[model samples]
Target: MEFSGCWRNILSVAIAVVLLSLAPPLAHTARAQSQAPASSTSNENDIRAATVLFYAAFNSALHGDLAPMSAVWSHRPDVTSLSAAGGHAKGWNEVYAGFQNIARLYPGGNIEQRDMTIVAGKDMGYSVCIETGQLRSSEGPMVKFNQRATNIFRLEGGTWKLIHHHADSNLNEADVSASR
Candidate 1:
């Protein structure tokens, strides 16, 4: 009878340990669910900011719309952009000038960004995806390219702005025109 009682006490202790271990995850899950709406709001805000940034790039490239571009960037000169050719453009002024150069070269061409994914953290977020566009040159037929890119954003004064951007084309000119 004493051996049976000892086994019962051991079983009780094991059950108590199991229950205690399970409590933290259950509490964590509950807390996460409670905060889910806030996370969702942040995600939506990040997506909107990212879309604006994409529009800024598109408009700056195609229509020379500096307003949209200016709206999505900080006035500070330290903002940076990394070109597809492994070149870096630092500061807002340099970045603006580079975009202008592309606009002047392309004239009436435009690129479209798609398949974007935006994820937000406490004060920062990342946007990643593919971009497709046509580049018209005075010397040849339209050139098209598909680029994969990642953009980092910082939230300042209740607005999210692009702090860094890096992009790379997936193909050379020879393969650029092939339909995917």
Candidate 2:
């Protein structure tokens, strides 16, 4: 009976040791699981707010205002933009130049975005949407535009800034000819 009692005590101690060894990893996993959803939710909210800021900047650009446009863009050499006019600009200098040209050619415009979908990760997010707008040309003609646009953003200094913008005019040869 004495030997059996000793054996039972040893077994109990071994079981407790095994459980204690597993506790840290199990606790860590539980903590991670609990935090995952909250992190995802926070990222989603941040991306949504950034998208709103992007549209505000876009509107400012449409009005031929460059200050908000400059603020909205990342201002990095790696930034890029593809205009709805089918022109591509790379780097900050080119992108800013393109906007300057836009301001000259298009005095003002009204852009409406629809069917937008945004996906975000830890430090980056993208939005795709259909854009329809009308711009007043310097020649006093109202030019209508329909485009499929995608905008990419990066988190910089706790603010989201546009890194890339690509937009397709969605105009065929016939449409171009008709516009001309």
Candidate 3:
């Protein structure tokens, strides 16, 4: 009887731990559901604008200007990015630094979205697109950059702000940076 009671207690504790593990995501989902837009179309449209602003800021960064980038992104701890320069940056500071590195690596480029697709969920949205452009490398040579990219955004204070941006292409970090 003693051994059986101990096993039951262990089972109870295991169940409690599982429940606690699920709490954060469940709470987040509830908040998202409460704040979800009635119109998915409206959400998509808003996220479209956010994507446009993000790409605009991205292009500006290629031109060695980061001011616009700051305006489009959420300055939150969850912000993240995976850039062409070959690094995974997490948090706003790290992500911003990645953008700075892009500005340094390619002082000039214009990447335009092609074959784009956008999806919007409760308080969250994402866009997948093909990015095509010619970027001038740090060595002053122009190279074609074609990348599959994904941008994620979340509603913050009634504004859609970028939380993540990922881009991948053939050019490596060494090729992108002359100083490498």
- The reply for model 2, stretches above 4 Å from the true place, is 1-34, 171-180
Model 1 accuracy (lDDT, Cα): 0.74
Candidates 1 and 3 compared by lDDT, better number: 3
Of the pair 1 and 2, which is ahead by TM-score? 1
Q: Estimate the TM-score of every prediction.
A: 0.75, 0.73, 0.72
**Candidate 3 residue lDDT tens string, 1-180:** 455888999989999999999999999999877766557879998988888888898898888789999999999998889876688999999999888888887888788877678999869999987777888887878887767789999999999999989888854465345222
Q: Candidate 2, TM-score vs. the true structure?
A: 0.73
Angstrom error of the Cα, residue 5, model 3: value is 58
- What are the lDDT scores of the predictions, listed in order? 0.74, 0.81, 0.85
Assess candidate 2 and give its lDDT.
0.81
Worst 10 residues of 3 by lDDT: 171-180
Sort order, lDDT high to low: 3, 2, 1
Write down the worst ten-residue block by lDDT for model 2: 171-180
Candidate 1 vs. true structure, TM-score: 0.75
Q: Candidate 3: lDDT of 128?
A: 84
Output the number of the lDDT-best candidate.
3
